[model samples]
Target chain A: GAGVSQTPSNKVTEKGKYVELRCDPISGHTALYWYRQSLGQGPEFLIYFQGTGAADDSGLPNDRFFAVRPEGSVSTLKIQRTERGDSAVYLCASSRTSGIPDTQYFGPGTRLTVL
Target chain B: DQQVKQNSPSLSVQEGRISILNCDYTNSMFDYFLWYKKYPAEGPTFLISISSIKDKNEDGRFTVFLNKSAKHLSLHIVPSQPGDSAVYFCAASAQGSGTYKYIFGTGTRLKVLA
Candidate 1:
């Protein structure tokens, strides 16, 4: 069984640039989530999607960050005018069902470095 | 606001010993707690979880204890193995109004010595 996966395991970009990170959730998963982890810190929630629409986007830091999941199985997180403070590992997770009890399986994060 | 906190940044214990990882939360709304383990360059893996209604939940060698009064939870690994060594994160979630979200701690790195 394939787990949640993120492409471009590592990305390096200059400040003020734009980048898009993609995530492929596990087969049959209906719930998706995005999180970011900084050095020496645990993952911070970014956005959550239930099916094709975003159920929650409160975790997104600011206008520079946006995510979309049109097909319900795949998601893309877009960042505009990247800053040095944005350097971190972006993680994606998915679960079989919706709610608090369902276990969310994670993907190997994509490390983004702002040069 | 950091609702969940793992004050100890790191912990070390020898194999065959009991490893205790502590976590505290400030939000009283949190009713479910979970533990996750992660290695370098990898995403976190779910370990075990306990609900606020129950004080303890055991799974094989792993046990999670929750103290609602103190808003504290601890994960105990009996006879800890080197393979168990990793960064442990504590997560809390509240269920209400049909909305759910998890708050995570800063994480505690554990080292199991052989």
Candidate 2:
């Protein structure tokens, strides 16, 4: 079975630019999550979606960050006015369901560089 | 504040020896703990997990031990192999608290010398 997949394995943008990262969760997975990893740091949770609705977005750093999963399978993470501080790897993950003890399957992260 | 902390940044072990990675958490609400292994330019892969209700969980060469009273956990790999070298992350989640999000530690780099 195919694991989670993220498009644009690498993205470079200038400061103040806008970028969108895409994720394709595993088939039949009802839960999707987004996280960001800074250099030498563990992944920080961003947002999560259960089915088509975002179950939690408290981890989103600021208003510039937003995510959506309209069809319940593919998700998009949008960032506005990119900042150098945002340079890091964005990761996506999915599981069978939400709020359970299910293990999460991760995708190869998309490394985003802000210059 | 970091809810999950992997105090050791890196560790090296000889092949056929035991590799132990430790993690601590400040949030007592965390009831589930998981270990993940990641290679460069790759996403993390689930390794093993232990529930707060159990003191230890073993799977093949990997074993996870939890100390709820100490708010600590350790992952031990017996007869470490060179292929086991990678960054290890410990994540904690409070499933009963209605939060599905996981809090991950900084990560520990483990090097297994053959």
Structural similarity to truth (TM-score) of each candidate: 0.97, 0.98
What tier of docking accuracy does candidate 1 attain? Answer: medium
Candidate 1 has which clashing residue pairs, if any? none
Could you tell me the TM-score of chain B in model 1? 0.96
* Highest-scoring model, lDDT: 2
Q: Give the clashing pairs for model 2.
A: none
lDDT of 1 at A22: 97
DockQ for all candidate structures vs. native: 0.70, 0.83
lDDT of 1 by residue, B36-94 (tens): 99999999998998877799999999999999999999999998999999999999888
Model 2 interface Cα RMSD in Å: 1.0
Q: How well does model 2 score by local distance difference test?
A: 0.95
lDDT value for model 1: 0.92
Candidate 1 Cα outliers beyond 4 Å, as residue runs = none
